[model samples]
Target: MQAILEEYLPNVMEIPDEFIEATQETIYMTVYTSLIAGVLGLFFGILLVVTRPGGILEQRVFFNILDQIVNIVRSIPFIILLALLVTVTRFIVGTSIGATAALVPLIVGVVPFYARQVEVALLEVDPGVVEAAEAMGTSPIGIIFRVYLLEGLPGIIRVSALSIINVISLTAMAGAVGAGGLGNLAVTRGYNRFQTDVTWVALIIILIVVFISQAISNWLIKKVSH
Candidate 1:
């Protein structure tokens, strides 16, 4: 196995440690960003749904402000966002390079996007169900927990899967800018050095990561739907 892999991916084999480190960094950035962004996105998403007009906790002013913020942040391209957040990332992590520093931009970029996803998921819940819950005198918290979250689980899963895949891509992009990961490996060690085998290996590794994420998400969605 080792001989075959080395023959096909000589560059990667030459720097086994770097390849391993890059892979770890990519996984770290993706998982860390996903978990943190997932919580924040759900909160903002829930707020967006609940504070909008006619919602259980309607507050147009708050909703509009939040909506606009999410939109604005979402509008910024991830690469540009990474550049824009350099100072902020430096402040948070004490250096604007590496996987840790990349977390700031990743979370910032993903939160609003996943929030929108969450908002859409929650919105898809039948209004009649919400009305019935309201008629039953269910508290806002109860309704949010039981009706919005429970009913929107599948949609949320679907969007989350999409978001996780997006995060994987972003991690690679983040690597492009010195956030050491497979992206960094591919760019710095592979593409820049004209090592096509290394580049292909890095790409294949990323694709495997994405495929695993999709598979898990599909399984979860199927189970939830059933």
Candidate 2:
């Protein structure tokens, strides 16, 4: 095992840029999906916070409906969700064989996950801030966007970072379909061919991604919170 790793490490380290086109694809897809998902997540998060019982808007009906929707979507397994949205993916992305093809599922998967995260984060904020906002005659939308969200910004960043990390993982699995990414590389060249070295390389790359995301997220939270 030692000799094998020693021999393969150099070659693995020397993979040409061409071999990593799909890796870049994963990054691009993840970023685009994160942007779309992040916005949708924030919207729903604020909606959840504001429309809950005794919240700024306090519409139980609206809150229940949104809650059920989030619960149902969240319950669906991600792999199944990916398979279920095949048509939508092709329609929007034009081809179901590349990173673009993966965007639809990525967004669908990330949005609900991040929305819940955002809701959880915002719900942790002190209730007095919301009450003060209402007492000041702040609009429902204004209070949600300005007060709850701003106060919970650090938690939001933490959740956003977590969502991005999960998105990266899901993107890797997408390689099982025609969606290309580091996962495809691991599947095709690493696992199938018994090249464990390639598998380790891909895994390391993913870990790097997680670490970078965490670091950047922490930095953002500190900067914004202060």
Candidate 3:
């Protein structure tokens, strides 16, 4: 195994530890950001659904404001968003470089995307189901939890899976800002150094992560789907 790796990736063999550390950083960023963003996205998504016109808890003004916020945030490019959020990231994390610091921008960048995914997922829930819940005197919150959430579980899982994949790519881009992940490894140690093997190795690892995330999402969606 060692001989094969040395033959194929001589540069990576020279800095196996760097590769390992980069992989760990990527995983840490992806997991924490996904979790944090997932919760916030879900909340905002449900809000969008509930406040839209003719919704159970409709408030056109509140809905418009929130909808605009999500849309505006989503419209900003990720790299530009990173620059824009530099001060906020520093205040929140007490620094602006490293895996932890990357979390702020990652969460901010992806929340709107994921929230929109959540909105799309929830919107798929049957209107008749919602009406039935309302007719049965269920509270808006109850309908949200039981009807919208429960009914949309499969689609939510699908979108969440896609969001995790998106987060993985974002973590790679975060490397451009000193977040120290596979993106850093590939760019700083591999591409910058002209180590084609190292770059290929990094790409392979990222693809593996994406595949695993996709597989898990598929399994969960299948399990939850009616």
Candidate 4:
């Protein structure tokens, strides 16, 4: 409501500073984790497709192992995985809690999902193209990178966009542990204090952020397609 905006504006006007800081953390968390996870996922996805059934890189043992790993990670709910990753996160980041520390869990947690997405997209590419590439003496790595990935790029972007949205959602949840962001502001200072106006404002801001991301992704994918 306009009233909510008016009521909370003064309190949160200075919030831009906190929002900026929190936004930086969110950006750091999203960018690094997404990059690491996307690259890892792309490799795993390529191998998954290439090694399965009659894939160019068919290898039963490797395919099964990768499939099981993907299933395992994808099966666990995000919050539960967040909890489980505590120690691994600490070992990786050298601490267990904070936006930066949270990136470890974020990467490990999302990689499999992204890999599966990449697998699906790559699989949609024409098998003939892959076969041609292979016949042309393209290495498995080169074929996977150049043929499958390039061909499926639009789909891959859509997948990445979906992952980015999820990352935003998960990071908001991470604020539960003082990760600090619009989510922390909403949950902590807003809900905990019965500041409904503040809660609404934070929620609106998060929605705006998500929408902005969605718009940018849509444009990028369209450009790639053309």
Identify the runs in model 3 with alpha carbons over 4 angstroms from their true place: none
Q: Candidate 1: deviation at residue 178, Å?
A: 0.3
lDDT comparing candidate 1 with the true structure: 0.96
TM-scores of the candidates in the order shown: 0.97, 0.92, 0.98, 0.89
Can you write out model 2's per-residue Cα lDDT over 116-204, one digit (the tens) per residue?
Answer: 99999999999898888889998887887788878998999999999999899889988767688788888887788877877888888
Best-matching candidate per lDDT:
1
Model 3 per-residue lDDT tens digits across residues 2-23: 9998898799899989989999
Model 4 error, position 40 (Å): 1.5
- Report the CA-based lDDT of candidate 4 relative to the real structure: 0.81
What TM-score should be assigned to candidate 2?
0.92
Angstrom error of the Cα, residue 169, model 1: value is 0.4
lDDT of 3 at 6: 88
After best superposition, candidate 3 residue 225: deviation in angstroms? 1.6
Predictions in order: lDDT:
0.96, 0.84, 0.94, 0.81
Candidate achieving the largest TM-score:
3
Residue 145 of model 3: what lDDT?
A: 91
Question: Between which residue pairs do clashes occur in model 4?
Answer: none
lDDT of 1 by residue, 1-226 (tens): 9999888878778998888999999999999999999999999999999999999999999999999999999999999999899999999899998899999999999999999999999999999999999999999999999999999999999999999999999999999989999999999989899999989889999999999999999999999898
Task: Please give the lDDT score at residue 219 for candidate 4.
Answer: 99
Identify the superior model by TM-score, candidate 1 or candidate 4: 1
